[model samples]
Target chain A: MNLKRLESILDDLEGFSDPNIRYEQYVTPSYVAARMLHTISLSNHIEGKMIVDLGTGPGILAIGSALLGAHYVVGVDIDSSVFQIALSNLADLDELFVGQPPIDFVESDVTKCVLKPKSFDVAIFNPPFGTKGNSGIDVSFIKAALDLTKVAVYSLHKSSTRSFIVKKGEQLGAKVEVLGQFSYDLPATYARHSKAVKAIDVDLLRFSHR
Target chain B: MKLLTHNMLTSRCLKGVTNGYPLKIVANEVKTENVDYNSEFIARVIPKVDWKVLSSTASDFGVSLPEEPPADIESNEDMLRKVHHALLEIEITQGDLICPETGRKFPIKQGIPNMLCNEDEVK
Candidate 1:
């Protein structure tokens, strides 16, 4: 599907009703998700690829990848409730899932789960930004995603952390590149945010293992 | 979860557990949904799956596979279909993925396997 079609399909997906602050559970906008997947597809990785989404809140990335022709997709998250929502969201788009396997939503923490290493072709997620009480959680998610895939990993992060993430990914033996930038619209979901909507500098990143 | 996923899952990192592979399944509900048969995808994924674990686990559900993957799987359509079904079609809707070494059960409810453990369970 094209970018406009992909974004429209993704816009219909349900978001977290009570997003956990600890996980930095923010709904990735459909426009951004569509853009990210489109970029990955340009690299010729989405079609016929085994894709995994770590911390897959509401299954947007996983579903988007499948919609883009990923062969088999797995969506992993620690939250148990999201899968129920994800399944229902998937069922809403029954026509789209005609050929694909229903996402295997494994309920597990990304850092700890010994998910088959170097097995999947690609990994994708909007990992916890590692804020609040959870420090370094973004790096943890990046590391976990890297372990699962042989080809590449895709994610979004704060533009401020580019240097740090670039260094960290290289230390882990992957070539990291910044793909694009956006103003991540974080609708105030928690008690702490004083604004109705908060927009933050966001950078889309790609890490590849050749 | 599909066998394609179970083929990769292991609670081996759980504290004090050894050989936590091929998690034993205790199925309360097993659901089979028909999916498209894609031979090329199945052929590509075959080498990544452990035949022993997949075949033995599939046998428990009465879908018997051969003792080993065929010599030339890319050319064998029937074998590819069977693996595709077992890997993508069959699911444990409500079950427990018990770690083999410790018998620690990670409950699978609503067709999703929750692998998170209690505080003391983490190393």
Candidate 2:
């Protein structure tokens, strides 16, 4: 499917039914997901490739990978409650493709989950940026992805963390590229937000492990 | 849990469980469903899969895979079909995925494997 049609379909995907504050769960905008997929497709066709979507809330990235012709897609999330919603979303998109790759959802923590080393071609995630203590959780996801994949990682993070991510990528001996920046509209789900939507700048960073 | 997921999972997170890989499958229930076969996909995934674990797990689920994956998997259509059936078509409806090292049991219900562990189990 073309990028435009894919974006529309992804737009219809259900986000958090009930957002979690501690996990900092926020739905990744379909446009951003589409844009990243399009950009990645320029260098990587995605067809017949193994893709893993870390923290796959409702399987948006995972389903998107399947649609892009990834051979096998695994969506891992700590929460199991969202799997049903994700499966339903996949069902809706399954009709569009003749033989989409098998998509699997694993209820596991991204940091602790043991995937074969270099098992996947690409690891994609929109990891939490909030600092748990001294460090942000996005670094952990990047580290895990680097450990798990052979090719590259596509991740979403707050634009402010660009330098930290780049430094971490260098430390891990990977090349980091800022693919694109987009405004993320954080809908006021919590009581603290005075506005209906709080917009913030976020960057999509791609780390190539050669 | 599909064998495809099983092939990548390990229980190494448990304390002192080095090489806690290829979790043993103790399947209480198994189901087979038709999934569209893609030869290219199967061929591509074969190299990534742990063939020994896949073969053993498939046998436990009554889906037979060859003892060894074909050397030239890309051109081996028959082997690709078998791998496809083993990975995508068969699902473990209910079971306990036992850790090889710690012997901890992760439950599978309605085809979803709960790999979460207690705080104490986290290491």
Candidate 3:
């Protein structure tokens, strides 16, 4: 819709703080977000189609999709902060379009959030890997993600827990595919005690509910 | 480092710790700069954090934080400011996060962390 408004919202969001300072939260970098969105839109022919971003922090992926001409983009996150930011971002975009198709932000957990099943053309996220007292919530998040869209793309670590999500996705009858893997650096404050936690292989997984 | 990595990392690389719950952070070089933050993002992530890991790590980074996080912190600008600064400001520009157990070194270079070890040492 309104590209300028989108830019302004992003600019404003940059000053707040690292959103992921909470828990299991990793804000997808702009490059990763842009790259993932491009891959999903191009591979799935998502232009002019409905798109959703689950766990949509700062609404980057969802906003990026809308900017790329998605018919509609919905971002859902359990955190009110995330939803608020996304709502603000979308509102700005709507202002630009002068009453275009609205971008939606729903505040709900990925597992329990109600979705318009089979209604979304594409869904994207950099999901949490229930490692840090995650309560293993990502399992339900992935299920909800796959259930809500025709095609879903996610970024995840290749930990044992994440591997289960990938395996289960295949069993769910979706045409599951692992697209790409890249290592992302953790922040400096993290204790450099592990075996390099080679775990953070940002996987671009495509799930075709077709 | 991102809390995502903090949540999953263990000090097993250095060796001899039964529970490497909180990896010790000894930052030789630290840089705190402009990292974007959105309150909404933090709120959503609160449930998924490893609080023990975070509070301990924050202290290591020279930040004194709350042991228990308050809910509805979104409207609390003061609290949010602290959260913002602790997470986004304190950057580890160059340093080693030593494993408390194994004493292995994970190098941070140019704001990026290299956790890769040689082939022989992996096991």
Q: Which one is best on lDDT?
A: 1
Instruction: TM-score for candidate 2, please give it.
Output: 0.93
TM-scores, in order shown? 0.96, 0.93, 0.52
What is the lDDT of every predicted structure here? 0.86, 0.82, 0.57
Provide the lowest-lDDT 10-residue window in model 2 chain A: A128-137
When summed lDDT is taken over every stretch of 10 residues in candidate 1 chain B, the lowest stretch is B33-42
**DockQ versus reference, model 3:** 0.01
Q: Count steric clashes of candidate 3.
A: 15
| Every model's DockQ | 0.73, 0.62, 0.01
Model 1 over residues B15-122: C-alpha lDDT tens digits?
A: 997758989899999988887777887798888889999999888887899989879879998888888889888988898999988889989888888899887897
RMSD vs true structure, all candidates:
1.5, 2.1, 16.3
Q: Each candidate: fraction of true contacts kept?
A: 0.83, 0.68, 0.00
Residue pairs of candidate 2 with colliding backbone atoms: none
Candidate 3 local lDDT, A84-192, one digit each (tens): 5555655565544423332455544556423335546567777765655655566566677777666554555444344676787777766767777656664433323
Clashing residue pair totals per candidate (backbone < 3 A):
0, 0, 15
Sorted on TM-score, best first, the list reads: 1, 2, 3
Query: Over the stretch A34-55, how does candidate 2's per-residue lDDT look in tens digits?
Result: 8888777777747778889999
